[model samples]
Target: MVAFALAAVFFLALCLSAREDRRRFRNAVLFGLTFISLSVALLLQLDKVPNWVAYPIVLAVFAVPTLGTLALGVFLIGNGVTMVRKEGRRPANLLSMLAGLGIFGMIALLMVVQMAGSRVLDGIVGTLAVIVAYISFLFLCFLGYAFLYGRIRVRGDVDHVVMLGSGLIGGDRVPPLLASRLRKGQDIYEAQLARGGRPPVLLPSGGKGSDEKVAEARAMADWLIAQGVPAEHITLEDRSTTTEENMLFSREIMTADDPGYRCVVVTNNFHAFRAAMMARKAGVNGQVLGSPTAKYYWPSATIREFVAVFWEHRAVNLGICGLLIALGTAATLTT
Candidate 1:
């Protein structure tokens, strides 16, 4: 019953997370499965559940960590291959490939260990493996939830809106990506004023492309001013090519009045978490808000964010994978 209850609760959390934040959906699926598996394993320990009933139920629960890790492993390997080929041997690219391969190797090793053992130690190892798997899954689930909560909470209190830019379409117009960021920023700016908050500053941050006519920052700043934002309320950060620089350089203007500040970052929905991560890295103290995105672009974008997160904490991700394989292998050999 406790097992079922836990599973039910985790499931509910996932459903809510997925519905509200698509970036969380993949993590949510794996998380819910892990929770359900643990719940069943707990149930199997009951005297009321017979070996015949309990063993299979336990087996099903135990399968999630191994299988989930295996799937993630394969994905990493595939992405690694793609990364190496497309990006050459740049250090960053190599790191990505290595991380992906690390997942693949761990999962593959676990499967091999499972295949080789059927003893008492094997059962023990299997149980341990499942625990580790559940832990990793939960961590990812928590990460998604934390980012979501932070995004929502911070946006709700935002008094200043910053739109980080990408390239413009045809070197002249707002692409969907940039437009999403701009619109969300504008909306929040208006909302704050409507609620009697003093007029929020709207900062459009981006530089020009090598072949472009105008800086994205200037273009976006103009767009907002045309929409009735007083020219005085707009700040143009016309010299940042990367997201990090966008926040850093913008922070200069943002803090020109006072070095200490709280502001809201605006980006596409799929990008909110990563953008927030960048904000933290750039030493900008603030939360992130997201604008809507077209459906077709989300999968690739979300995957990119996951990869970025993995890189952001390489030792932790790989260490967890290593521990899972070791525990699973040891328990299998022992039980």
Candidate 2:
């Protein structure tokens, strides 16, 4: 009953946090707590069931996480190889592969420690394990909440659909990734019109890269025009470089056009939640929508997103990690 009550409290906190601002990282943590508490409550009640059912449940509880971790490690390694082949050898592309290898390395380290029986090594492993567990928990929370956030639709009419820009291919052409965002933005504009609402202005937000012949917004604007969107409906925000700039500069443009304006920002699905968080911080009067991304690219991209979020709140995250490590070290010494 205490576990059940804790789950309910976490669920209520999650609801309130999401209601206040769906983009909050706190919502993700609360969501994770709710899920964990509920799982614990259910597991605690397993004793009431028949031995036959309880046995399987107990076996699954122990077996699934181990099996799942191994499976995930393999999958990430495979996807990483595919990413390198299909994409490029950029460091970003290597994240999934490195993560997969890291998992196996940790597993090996655990085995080695167990065999060697060194107290110092045991303490170190224990500290690392707790840190890894904390990070993994946070990653799962971010992933689950991001999926939920992507599904949420913008309510009422929006005055602008801001498509955040990515790097152009060949220094002048829209890459498939940026094109996806543009298409999603166009669809939103068309949907509003189809629903008998006024068509929202399309804002392609990106500045020129050093190697690019033109600003990204110009390339995106050309793409939108070629797709049959009216030239008049397209606004070029050709000054912002980063994602934060994308939100802030676009907000400036939208606010200049209409102080009372509402808008929807668009980015790739993996980037959507982080962009939404940035948009909120930038005081953009809007929510963000995610366009589809390639399947093989998602894990690495999502990991990158999580890393960025983790760094954005590094003070708190690092403090907790340090605290955990200290406690683990103390406990090991005592033991």
Candidate 3:
């Protein structure tokens, strides 16, 4: 009953938080709370079953996830090889592969320690296990919420469609990644026109890089013009290099024309939630939409984005990690 009640409460809170601000971190927390509560409710029902049946069911649940994790590790490693072969041998491209290797390495180290039967090794592993558990829980939450946030439909109307910039391929040519964002922006612009109102302005946001021949905004604007969007409907915000600057400068342009401008920022699917978070922090009155990305590129890019978010909240994360380490040390001393 308690579990069911908590589930109900969390579900209500999830709905409320989502309604209030889908971009807020509280929505993720509420979603996780609701899921955990419901899971507990389901598990509690197993108390009514015979121990023989319930015990096997419980064991299978744990075993299945362990097997799944191992399988995922293997898949990441293979995908990393494919990324290196097709994409390049850059450090950024190696993250997924490295992560997979790290997972397996940790597992192997634990097994070795167990085999050695050393008290010191056992104590270290125990401490690590607790810390790993907490980090894993947070990772799951981030993955789940990022997926959910991207799936959310940005309906009604928007006054502007802001496309964030990725770097050029050959000094000025639009890369597939940046082209994907432009395509999504064009779709949004057309959708708004079809709804029988003034079409939203398409704002391509990016500054010139040291290596680039022209600004990213200019390249994006040319792409939109070639795609049949009128020159008047497109605006170029060509003086911002970073995503934070993209939002800030775009907001400046929008506010100069209309102070209460509602807009949707566009980026790759993997970056939508993080961009929306940045937009909110930058005081932009808009949400973010995502375009499709290549499957092979998503894991590392997503991991990179997650790392940025973790770093953005590093103070809180470090505080929690400190507490966890303290708890582990206390456990070791007591034992």
Ranking of candidates on TM-score, top first:
2, 3, 1
TM-score of each: 0.61, 0.97, 0.94
Quantify how close model 2 is to the true structure by its C-alpha RMSD in Å: 1.3
Q: Cα RMSDs of all predictions? A: 7.9, 1.3, 2.1
Q: What lDDT tens digits, residue by residue, belong to model 2 across residues 116-231?
A: 99998999998998899999999999999999999998877899999999899889899999999999999999999999999999999999999999999999999999999999
Worst 10 residues of 1 by lDDT: 20-29
* Candidate 1 lDDT: 0.70
Which stretches of model 3 miss by more than 4 angstroms? 49-60
Q: State how far residue 197 of model 3 sits from its true place (Å).
A: 2.1
Residue 288, candidate 3: alpha-carbon lDDT: 91
Predicted model with the maximum lDDT: 2
Residue 265 displacement in candidate 3 (angstroms):
0.8
In terms of TM-score, which candidate is stronger, 1 or 2? Answer: 2
